[model samples]
Target: MNEIFVKSLPLKDVIANIAEALDTTYFNRCNEYILNIPEIYGEGSIRGINFLNGFGLIEYNCTLKEALKIHFNVNSIHPLKFIYCSKGSVKHKFEEHDVLHQIEQFQNIIVASTQQNGHILIFPKNENIHLNSLEISRKEFKTKIDCDLNILDVGLKKLFKDLTARNLFFYQGNYSLAMSDCIDTIKTSKFSGIARSLFLEGKSNEILSIQISDYEDDKKDIPKRQILRKSELVQIQKAVQILKSELSKPLTIKELANKVGTNPTKLQEGFRYNFGLTVNNYLNKIRLDYAKEQIMIGELNISEIANNIGIANKSYFSRLFKATFQLNPKEFSLQIAKNANKRQRNRPLT
Candidate 1:
């Protein structure tokens, strides 16, 4: 196994360490540590990790087969937390006492100051382990969540992931040493009571938001898989049935969330989680399917189909039908007609 480990003790000491690590021949060279890794590792593949601590981001693009650990001394004064993921499919064996729920594929894992005490195990694409670390300061985080959490909650995970995914976005914009200093500060001190509470609250709210967003995305994007919790599935089943029976009118997201006994965010999330599609996407799919069935009966035109299906826009409906089935509404109707004709022709000679 080939291993290269490097550490920087302080702002000034960083240079000496780098110099010492590289001898005279390999010296007179300039080297810097990237805050995130942007490549994947495997046979015939180039994998690397990068972190942009100054920009509050981390990313990895390699695989590992054993348990790996990185312990850092964060100044208690400024704590940091981030979402981490493997580039390709990777299994994580989080310590027994840590995870509140099971972690699965496409699952967003939170690495906060408190939950940072554990080993991260990865199933590698090759016979090696590669890791990267990103740093964010508690004070910088406070600025992000100082206001009410309602807005930031909607896309916390996305923001965190995006930060790591786009290294240039963070490192290219004056975030190099500034972020490093912030991280160094956190490694050595503690925070006051008020700041600590605010920080914890921010982390909790962000995590909740991340889960909610995933749930919503799933409901809209997924169709064949059952992914929601038992309770959420029960709620979605009820909502779907009710919506089907009341096809003449569409149910608003808030209404569906309320009827399903969940908040709008939760209801949407539950719908996504259970169906792998967002609530709106699933609802539209149901509406379109119903419309197609009605069209087979030859009782409605495009306008009627839209109205009956509770779609607001006739033009939009046509486009959506084409998009969904790769055929225009008229074409689809004619195909159905041809099928019916063929079936009639093949019917028993009675």
Candidate 2:
């Protein structure tokens, strides 16, 4: 029954206050703050980088030692939240729904321009979690950009029409690779100081843009595909899990479809409708993401990384890696090594 109250403040302050409540000191450099919880509190940590004008990125990767609830009060103007649960789950209830809404792994949820006093989030104990959240203050958005709001998707337009509304508009769906890439860039970028702040700001804006574009695409695709039955949705989700777990195996779409108890056409259509990617495209995206992660670990050579991800042709793997990340595998590996070395040199003597 542990509870934490978070007042509406800039994201950096929010993070700082949480660390204080947990009796931990946060490492501060430039506008970024990183908190590592001790074993008594939890395992893992929280990292956040904020822009003074009100946009910020907060990343949480932790396992709570006990169940905890968070109450967040939105005191800022035109507050918006874009949240993705890359691992584990969290639950919350909106004003309109009596039932709790769960954001599970590989899913995303967005809250737009809510005027509600606050919302509650619950985290279960001993569950490993990874969450990335982007917060935007509409005032900051307006001051930073000169573009017309009408250029955005209709869904976003309606969300912004009445900034004073007590009820918030919500959007939830499968997290897209495009959105994932933006977050990966923000997390792995080697920049520091002002350069790091600027990199995060650019990445945050890029994520917002991708969300809008994805919303528009979903709107168009909704009409074309028939509504999926709950059972079908379950099967498609199972397929996704299988695909992720079996990255090292070369499984054709037909094989995946059969394994998931669906046909090729339904499988392909279901993937596009539910996840916004073709089977091949989604597979490739996950493969490249895995390869990138391995490269970042700095424990494997480029060929080893490629082979571990099921790519037989190292040259082809490099091509796909470059296409997705805009950097060749070797170059990306070198960058990760350079960053690790810099951090090592900067560490203070114990």
Candidate 3:
């Protein structure tokens, strides 16, 4: 058994204390706390930024050299956390539960723990973990709902039903692609200072909205014609990786299916079931997003971007871009340039 570090405080203070305990330096910008742990902790880092007074975003990326357990006994208010494990895994042990709840990669977990008896997180050694969490204090959450808890999704309502109850509620599910995209944007954003904080805050709230909407959609009685088994799910994910890796090549659905050792039907159904997009739609989305990124870089022309993304018909690519982003490729490129110019002009004299 590894040694556990226990702390009883509000969430933000707990994060700062963890950095201090590990002898790390942290930046306390207005509402953002960026903690960079030393090499002794295996290059661990945590970024916490508050949006509202009691609502915030936490991004954790680390490879620990030793096991660390953080037991958080909430001091001020019971907190509700919406957590996504993007890269690795984590285990949560509640005070009242004997079983450890596992949050694996590509999964989301929602937890509401009482202030009197909070939860614990155990991080194992030598494994790279990336987690993004959206935390809201109970009081703030209730205020946002106008004190009408009934407006929450059934799953969320159950998790937060009895705020005064001294028990922990946990719900775990597969996160949708929309949520994943938001997380990736937040992770890879190049903005800094106030721009960075605002970007993170907006994306965090977008993730929360997507999660709640997805939960409600799951509750609806959608037809289950394309049910995929566990092994088939793995195969489809491999296909996705292959598609992403070979983006420069124009691969047909048949080629993709054969490469992943699955039939075309199963591959198509898997995309629909797991990713909520048809085969062509998904591939087009990938290509368009890549093209838009290249435009943002301001390095490639519209036709060159189209060619690089394997689309020879520039007009068709422009139409796809319009449909996806409501902006044609040229218009989007000009917008990026305009924004860059504005940022340069707005820079303060130092």
Candidate 4:
């Protein structure tokens, strides 16, 4: 856990640009700082700023002496905030909506997005506020578990009790390393966008997995089937292995789970438990990954790759492929062709 300081807004801008390139409408114009929440939303407007565009999580450490400002709306939507208390207690003021509330000492807070714009605040004080945001997707989120909203406040508090010690010892002045690892996890996975949505929407599976991973590392005993359990942990590796071996075969959650000696429920839970994705999501990831490889090789047509990956419906497969890789199969093929042509032209005639 090396520590490196980062300015959040620039990172947000990079994410917004990527979202625009990917055509993610939700993050089309997400350009604002997390500290400046009001700028992200317009009064009486439906658009909310998308931090998910970056495809990673964020954390904050701050203290307030004034009441944080918030907006309100009449739309039925999701809640988007995770708060925790390390020292002083804070109060909620929502006349328009009954926001689900939680408060705990020395825990983490999570902020999720809803359908409409609303406001929330922590009691401003001289006390330092430490917060962490871990991006995740809806499918990877554990809505069925018992989660303390306040736990979202203390970033990864469930993993390490001695925040100062862990921060000082493990992080060892390399916060950027931690951030890099998180960003890499998102970039390498197919559940990239969904992970951000889940984190903002108070989805607990991502946080739980983080907690469980930390607990196991610390040699702590947890009773439930945590995400890091050996049986559960192996499914992701198995899915990846199977996907790599059978890229040309049709994949189903039931089949994959059965092959790994687990049911769909456990398979789904565990796949997302260790990785920030469900079984099906992982399958899509592999399909798309292979699609890219085939394009680069330029030995297969779009339909061939689609059908080979068990995507019989060309239109739907094309859409899913584009959504995952940010380019239609044709476009991807053309780009690869362009690169090959460029290389060939640059080669000296023998």
- Superposed Cα RMSD, model 4: 19.0
lDDT agreement with native, every candidate: 0.45, 0.75, 0.75, 0.46
lDDT of 1 by residue, 152-185 (tens): 4344434443322221111101111222223334
Q: Please identify which of the two predictions, 1 or 3, would achieve the higher TM-score against the true structure.
A: 3
Task: Estimate TM-scores for all models.
Answer: 0.35, 0.63, 0.65, 0.35
How far residue 151's Cα lies from its native spot in candidate 4, in Å, is 21
Worst 10-residue stretch by lDDT in candidate 1? Answer: 167-176
Error of 3 at 55 (Å): 0.6
Tens digits of per-residue lDDT, candidate 3, 1-350, equal: 24445343344576677877787667887668788867877777887777765678777899888877877776655578888888879898776677898888888877877666777888878889998878877665666665656887766776655556455677777776567667778778899888987887788778888878756655655432222333347888888887777677867998887787766766887898777898888888888889988888878888888888788888898899999899999888888889999999999999
Displacement of the residue 16 alpha carbon in candidate 4, Å: 58
**Looking at candidate 4, what is the lDDT of residue 68?**
38
> What's the CA RMSD for each of the models?
14.8, 14.4, 13.0, 19.0
| TM-score of candidate 2 on Cα atoms, chains taken together | 0.63
Q: Pick the candidate with the highest TM-score.
A: 3
Q: Report the candidate with higher TM-score, 3 versus 4.
A: 3
